[model samples]
Target: MQTEYRYITESLAINDYGSGDRELVSVNDGPGELDELFQRVGFYSASHDFRELCGFIRRFPKIGPYNALLLHIQRPGCTFVATAKEWKTDFNRTVKPGARPLVILRPFGPVNFVFDLQDTDGPDPFPEDLLEPFKIHDRSREAECRYALDRLLNAVPADGIAFYPSDFSTAAAGYIETAGIGSWQKFRGHQLKVHYNHVVSRNLPPVEMFASVLHELGHLYCGHLGTVDKRAWPDRKHITDAGIKEFEAECVSWIVCSRMGIDSESEKYLADYLDQNSRIPDISLEVILKAAGMIETRIKKGIPVPKSMKIS
Candidate 1:
């Protein structure tokens, strides 16, 4: 019993040990019973396989992290010799077992002893629907950003002004009408219409275009337009309100672009905006993060957005 207790304690220590210590301890006893045990429990192999298994397990929302790990390693009908409460609460299956208990770490709580696959049924959880919504095709960051941008553009509401390639003599790279008669004509309800200058679009890289579109979309989604009166659109206060609106939009663009691995001038833009007056809005960080997540999800799902038939 004392030997069993020591073994159990050492096994638990493996989880907390550094890589060197773990490897040393696993091999120090000279490749006998413990080595075989490590192999059986999946501690002997490279982490790549474990990572893949974890990725697969993460896709299933019904399974908890600990349960997922156990399901990955534990075999069917394995005996789980945990406490009665653990047996009742954690284990899905219970069977009579006469063999000695096998000490295995529980997914949660303290260390406990379990028997073998024959004594208890193990979990076999999987994604409910085989079809995953967000199937990203482009592996490169720039390509992915462009793809996401295209999807977002195509999803603009019908009432929103259609984006078109247009040659503008002015230096502006893009424009969005947030207020005034132009806004009333272009915006539908909450949707904001944006247009990119063809000269700038053609000159800039696809990633830049992605950044530009995301910045514009950030303005629309952040409720910047709704904050101002349509008649009093482009108000000086709105543009320079301690860089509130611009900072918010640029930050959104920066986050989304960064996640997609696209380099952006959003930081520079934010710096310039902040130069006007160093202050950020009281906007919720959760709101910005959630919005970025939603946008990325929409992009990955390949939500169809019709091309603008009207060319300028």
Candidate 2:
């Protein structure tokens, strides 16, 4: 698809999706939502110390991300954990007779319990690699990460939402830029308003830019900024607590970023946010994952969303 717009001095009109090298294409598939496991894990991941949690994820690459997080919360500072059978088979060790077990969700069956290596009787047979924090000595994700961000931004859905770069400060990365309070999109023949336009900072890297846009979109899509169309999104502006809005948006950003293997600052930001508060905010897990799934499906391919070309 081809879109054209001239960059103005103060305001930008980014009607274009590509710069000759890349172009947008339309798709017929609908977006997806996170499953129940992710729905629960995603919430916990956001509120906790995810930077350290990510370390656990790195240390235990075999366990899934959700399981890693579960292990981190249930047992902090745990270097390695394994099932009793795995300990006996993989490391030739055995769990103590009655060592307390840590629980993790099992995808196919009931919950499972794991024993930490310290709780097991082993001869310390691990090589240096197993003892040290696993690091990629031969390669890095720099190139793939850059491409992921580009692909993410380029796959922006065309649902009356237009993204443009702005001179936003370091304190603020980006924000929603609408024509007015009730912006409308003209689709087929009908015209209706939507509050989905965005403005990201030009100074940010691909990850930061993608994250900034998602944060802003999260606010609008999650109905923190008042929903003009309840059918498209909900109307949750009644949630007067600003922390709740920020929490939900960061959760969306963290989930999507984690999916792409790009560690975003949302982990740090959300962790810090919780440190200053006494209790966790009342957030909607369903909405957060729904928003994340929508963004995820859009970035999967160059798909034109069900939107209109006319905006007013």
TM-score of each: 0.40, 0.51
For residues 112-182, what per-residue lDDT tens digits would candidate 2 score against the true structure? 68998888997767555664533434223456556765665665535556566888766678888555665
Q: Write the per-residue lDDT of candidate 1 for residues 1-312, one digit (tens) a residue.
A: 355346635754464211100111121212223334544554413334533442443332232223323334443233123444454466554535564554333333444555443554446432224223124434346666656767765554321435655554334557555433433123323334333211234445677777776776666544454423221112222344645677667766766665444557885674554455433344333224333443554455433322331222
Output candidate 1 Cα RMSD: 19.1
Ten residues in sequence with the least summed lDDT for candidate 2: 1-10
Q: What does candidate 1 score on TM?
A: 0.40
Model 1, residue 210: C-alpha shift (Å): 0.8
Cα RMSD to native, each candidate? 19.1, 14.7
Candidate 1 residue spans exceeding 4 A from truth: 1-140, 158-161, 169-171, 178-202, 227-242, 269-281, 302-312
